[model samples]
Target: MNNIDTRNPELEGLAKCPTGIRGLDEITDGGLPAGRPTLVVGGPGCGKTMLAVEFLVRGATVYDEPGVFVAFEETAGDLAKNVASLGFDLNGLIAQKKMVIDHVHIDPAEIEETGEYDLEGLFIRLGHAIDSIGAKRVALDTIEVLFSGFMDHAVLRAELRRLFSWLKEKEVTAIITGEAGETTFSRYGLEEYVADCVIALDNRVVNQIATRRLRIVKYRGSAHGMDEYPFLIDADGFSVIPVTTLGLDHEVSSERVSSGIKDLDAMLGGGYYRGSSILVSGIAGTGKTSMAASFVNAACARNERCLYFAFEESEGQMIRNMRSIGIDLGPWIESGLLQIHASRPTVHGLEMHLAMMHKLVSEFQPDVVVVDPISNLISVGNGLQVRSMLTRLIDFLKSNQITALFNDLTQGGGAMQSTEVRVSSLMDTWLLLGYVEENCERNRVLSLLKSRGMAHSNQMRELILSDDGIHLTEVYAGTGGVLTGLNRLTGEAKTNAAEMRQTQDLDAGARAVRRRREALKATIAALRAEYESELDELDASIARERAQQIALEDDCSMDER
Candidate 1:
């Protein structure tokens, strides 16, 4: 049989392997160095094997790069079955002669090292498998197993050097996975000096919260990210997300899109900019999803295609439930104006979710995208990973000029407080919804927390969902308080009671004033009559005096006349 040419001169200038993992390639500046051995050193259960397997599988499926998997720990069958849940058909690939899986079972109890033991047998087997299928990628999972089975450390080290030289000679991009020790990184104690690239994976638990971290310790002759990045492992596989290093060169758009609610649109100074990301954060049952759905419906009504990614609820269930709130997604779906992609947060890795979303966005070419309750996704990964994932997602949407809406569920008495602390700075517009207890009953209130590059109403508006659809009524500002929910009605009643008391006080004062005025008028009339009677009596007395004195006054009167 003609020996396959394993030597590749292009390996010196080879591009990084894309890995086909969303957000990960961006962090690694494309992918791991091509045609070179990279050491993946990690503790137990840190996803070393999973990452290697995924790399090989992605190469096989996505990039059409045939690969070989050499497992020193588990049998080839077990590896295949374990990853079957992730939708990888390793056995089929092997059967099709496109891939090779070599199980290297080396039991320490069976080893009788009378002389120098060389890994020449293992190398021969690897060459046979690779030559069989012309494989371009190879993975040796947990090389530490071979070292642990042998007590001859010097021989193992010498053999490891030869193995690396042989792999370089083979010219296939190789990944060597080794178990991490308690203090040192690799169990073999050879990772630091032999590998062209070193990658470390760590899993840590603090306060009942488990977090996975990945770091590129060293990469020879190439610039690489040095910071520890966050990652997640789910149904699909491992995904690494590096935090964004924001640059001023990001694309910007001045185009605007309509808010689903007319009044809310008016409040937003026209509407949100096209491609701008809006965050709707609120407590449980605060209608965040309803608001997002209303916007999606509005977009659909405008004949603009939209995608809704529901993490907490199934598409069918969401459709059925939202119908009661006046949002009928079924018609939109049937008309192809709306598409709902619903999946659990843990159903797949964050990278897988992002890749699926990227694919959907490309295929649908939607004008709007909605992620209902992004906080549920936050639960699947660490803080750094979640933040990085969101940043990349937002950047992708912004670059594409796709209007994106994200919902975040808030917890505790100050539900949105944590969200504000964590994610508010990343959002272009922040909408807050919550329960307000003003009266004896509770009510729902919606408010615009902030809107960048646009003026927005600071007042809290009451959101009402009737048969007509979602409605935002005028903000109620009265003596009691602003209208929230049932409490607003109670506040209105209290305000009315206070106003009635004031009215009754004014009526009592008017009655007292009328009584005093009537008493004064009667007294004046009586005084006037008494004065007239006295005047008449005085006139009669004067007349009688005049008559008696007439005889005497005749002569005086004649004289006076």
Candidate 2:
């Protein structure tokens, strides 16, 4: 969107000059109104000058459009020196004939207010600078100096009107900076209406904390963001972070990614979907960082690059800690598959951090991104800003199809809830990690709170961390409640004893039945043996009687034969 091409038909009627500042082009739908004057009103030290300078510098560098900077309060050398740290080589650009810096000092004490006094000299100088470089952009840094130099309002107003009209006639997009006044957009209260666009910059100390913000007051013939956006002036330049885009229209991925823990993946129904937001909420010492590190390790193991944002712990500290748990992230870091970026939550404002995330993500183009303990951001801003920043971050990651894992630290010992970030609804999977105190010991338990578009497990498992890695175990439940530690062991022992007794009784009963069958068989065998012996004896006795009878009837048998 920042690539506002002059040949682009969509931007023909509404010619937009791309600011090249991060996130500002999206807020403006392209950039400031092209070939028209825009009034930038802000108090002292509110980055108005910086914004204007960056616009011109970026125009010359990125857009290949020449620009001229007309400074009335500061010298050309000072202007160049001030923006040198931003990596803008004004001198180099000037040498290349891409940019022109013309400083016109307007000191009220040195100027003489005479009749028929006009800014013809100033106009001729500005016009000469523009014509010399064929510039398409111009910046008049703090035009309020004109009001200070001229006493008569009518003369200044008429000249200002003519100058603005002349700028439009020149067909060059212009930025006119003005000093903000009490109850007025500008000190003159005229530039705001004279320009086609008006933008307000504010830098205020709220509760002793400084914050810089920007707002688009008006833009003729265009739709622009009206809400106050937090902007940052860092080494890169002015970066406006607009409000998070609201909608669920982002494309989703059917691909699944491991949560690093095998049991956790099973609980999540085969792991989190790609381009999904995962929330790991737990109290201090509940292993939130460990979970996040495990996920990073898993992503790296798959040869996928991961961006790890460490809010509390330093990168080395996190690596060492994970190594203690037998999860070696050293290999991933060495292989360039994992990038651990550590920063204190209070190091910068929330929007600045958000912008930095965007900068890093765009550069790294990682497949997975992890923010360890996002709840620490609550210390930097209110709930709304935190939520907005995270929402935008999630949106950005989703747009890039990057899997996001957020480790959240919350207050311990309460009803299960989302982190202080309060973005549970935006998460695709929410895992609740808390402690279950039993037998004077605290045992960590993990459960799947929410998993969209998939069937997830609802059972709470004992989360055991050892040198081997994460392990999920079934906890013994009894009359009181779920049991763990020695209580769980005692319960298992009693269960084992009962099972052993039942098995012994079954074995004893089988032995008794076998003994009774053996006794009955032996008795039957003895009775049959006795009957056979009796039959043998009775046959022998009959044979003896028959022999006696045969002896007596021998003579009769011979006669009968």
The lDDT leader among the candidates is 2
Worst window of 10 by summed lDDT in candidate 1? 1-10
Checking candidate 1 for backbone clashes, the offending pairs are 439-487, 443-485
C-alpha RMSD between model 1 and the true structure: 10.3
Native-vs-model 1 lDDT?
0.81
Q: Point to the candidate with the largest TM-score.
A: 2
> Model 2 segments beyond 4 Å from truth?
1-12, 246-255, 300-307, 315-320, 329-342, 355-368, 477-481, 519-561
RMSD of 2: 5.1
Clashing pairs in 2: none
Query: What is the C-alpha lDDT profile of model 2 across 135-157, one tens digit per residue?
Result: 99999987778787789878888
